[model samples]
Target: MTYYVAREGSKLWKRVLGETKVELQLLGEKWKLLLVGVILQYIHGLAARGVHYLHRPGPILQDVGFILLPELGKERAYISETVFSFMFFSFVLWTFHPFIYQSKRFYTVLLWRRVLAFLVASQFLRIITFYSTQLPGPNYHCREGSKLARLPRPDNILEVLLLNFPRGVIYGCGDLIFSSHMIFTLVFVLTYQKYGSRRFIKQVAWLIAIIQSLLIIASRKHYTVDVVVAWYTVNLIVFFVDKKLPEMPDRSTGTSPPLLPISAKDKDSKSKEEQLKLLNGNSLDTSDRRPRTQVNGKHLEDSNPVNGDATMNGT
Candidate 1:
């Protein structure tokens, strides 16, 4: 019993040490990601504030999606918020999945770095898009009865920066054109599709993402175009960004799998197999055709086949 305990304890220590070494080696990369992430988030926050201040109440534009789908009531709008919150928290929980799944290659920090990269690019485009034109706000907060219908002009830069925080986004207006909520949802879904192991969970993730989009549209939290644009834009951003990023290392091999075309390897293997088969066939044919002598009504073969010399025995 003691021996078993000691063996297990040693294994645990070794794993911990190995993980530590890998993390320490990546310390510089981790810090760089952290710094860039913080800066990008701050810039996005400021941009959101600027767009919100530029918002003006106007007639809602004619939208095909609105004509097709009925706008959900205020209660349903709250439900949409709830659903988004669930997705956000679920993604946060999933970020730490490497701990639960025991994957050396897929660390929580690495996942965050990848997610941050995708979001930063997405948000950067969003800022440029929303800044191009101010659209009429569509949510209940943008309507007359709501207290937050029209945002008061900012007195100073500090107020503008502060207003872009979480509380501000809750009742804020004019950061449309592409949905931030959809960006997060799609990023999480795509990341899970690539890295997560369970088939059921992957399907469930996609379902949740689809449902989340519907809820955003139904609740009128965003214009239909916002949701529609997000659907394709986020998907494309993830696809392209994933292509640029380094592939994750496999735990067993401690190296990333090659992303080269599979047909090349297959062709090489096939050629080798063909050559081996031909050599084998030729050897069989040569052995059968080799000369044999009959001595006293019995067949005898050469002692050495390599030289191909024939020897005869006579009575």
Candidate 2:
């Protein structure tokens, strides 16, 4: 898949993406890794809900509601709670979009590991750092005379797990310190930038995120502080995840580390020497780069595993 590497500029995302004809493929298919990701998301959701309810049946904090973001507001967009639904609907769609499109397949094993790790860490952090505050919103007015007089009754982890569907999906008012929509937006936006695509597509991906976050404020689903904090938190996570989980290489190779950590050049000359030593049963130098060997010497002469048959020089 093509990935757009942004040029050096203030608006990095606006830089055009070009393909160098190098199609990167991971070592073999990672169907099982993708499957594990699906399962982990389910577990993460379960755990998030489990911990979310632990601090519930508590006091309401509507102090964050007074700071009006009227400029970003859409009049009556949430008149009957439609915008919130659309926000949620779009979020759900975006969650699975890359998977279906295959243009930016989230199928890489390294990517899957990073995503699962992010979910685990974020959820754990959210669970431990419970801030009992409510930012004013359409479905989240915790005042006494409001439709929802107080926050919903807290449910046990098992009960929440069993109750499922709409009930499980809904979040309470006090859990609005940070917005998941913001975090999710960053995830997809960075993913678009990483997977090699047009600059326009990348911009649109991030634009949607910004609009959604603004709408969250307009619709009163979150405070400005919520969105701000989420942006910072998710961005930090993105940096670490990218640094730790480097992209995988060609799919034909098995699941082994590359000879050079970040070097595209194979160090073929060096590998060739190692291959010859292995063939002759020489004790190798202490290095992690053990050369690839022919399985049974049943392959072609060109398949000498490194520099073809040229190394069998005087034979």
Model 2, range 26-109, lDDT digits (tens) per residue? Answer: 323445665666776676566545444443333333434435555334455453245345544543464444333424433334
Clashes of each: 0, 5
Which candidate leads in TM-score?
1
Off by over 4 Å in 1: 1-25, 103-105, 252-315
- The residue-by-residue lDDT of candidate 1 on 86-176, one tens digit each, is 8889889876544444554476667788889999999999999999987888887875556676667767777776764677868778888
- The TM-scores of all predictions, comma-separated, are 0.72, 0.53
Question: In candidate 1, which residue pairs get closer than 3 Å at backbone N, Cα or C atoms, i.e. clash?
Answer: none
